[model samples]
Target: MGFVPSQDADKIADTVEPLAERLSEVLGVDIQAQVLVDYTGLVEG
Candidate 1:
């Protein structure tokens, strides 16, 4: 995923972590996951 500012990365992580945890608990397994936010501009010439 991509975001305009770097701060958005933290925000996204905060939102997704709990859900990931809940999913892990429900499935009774350790689910390895990661949320990566690229703070880069996409330009075309």
Candidate 2:
């Protein structure tokens, strides 16, 4: 798996890297996941 930053800053990049690392180790495989910042309304558009 690989890691990438969508934009420039600590907030976005800082979020997913550790999660991917830990997930990779815990799953005992090359694990990859995307972190989506869901600021949109959950109930409706």
Candidate 3:
């Protein structure tokens, strides 16, 4: 999957990164994910 950058820098790596890692480990796949900033940014992407 692919996406364009959002408006705000609300990545929240501390939370999102670990969750993605755990999910990937449990599911046995390289899960690519992203933390969106807001509704508009999410919709546009």
TM-score of each: 0.56, 0.42, 0.52
Candidate 3: stretches off by over 4 Å: 1-11
Model 1 RMSD in Å is: 6.7
lDDT of the candidates, in the order given: 0.57, 0.56, 0.61
Best by lDDT: 3
Pick by lDDT: 1 or 3, better one: 3
Q: Write the per-residue lDDT of candidate 2 for residues 1-45, one digit (tens) a residue.
A: 333445653565567668878988898988665434342422222
lDDT at residue 21 of model 1 (Cα atoms): 84
Worst 10 residues of 2 by lDDT: 36-45
lDDT of 1 at 24: 86
Best candidate, TM-score = 1
The residue ranges of model 2 lying beyond 4 angstroms of the native Cα positions read 1-10, 33-45
State how far residue 19 of model 1 sits from its true place (Å): 0.4
Looking at model 2, residue 40 earns an lDDT score of 41
Clashing pairs in 1: none
Q: What value does the lDDT take at residue 8 in candidate 1?
A: 70
lDDT minimum window of 10 residues, candidate 3: 1-10
Q: Name every residue pair that clashes in candidate 2.
A: none
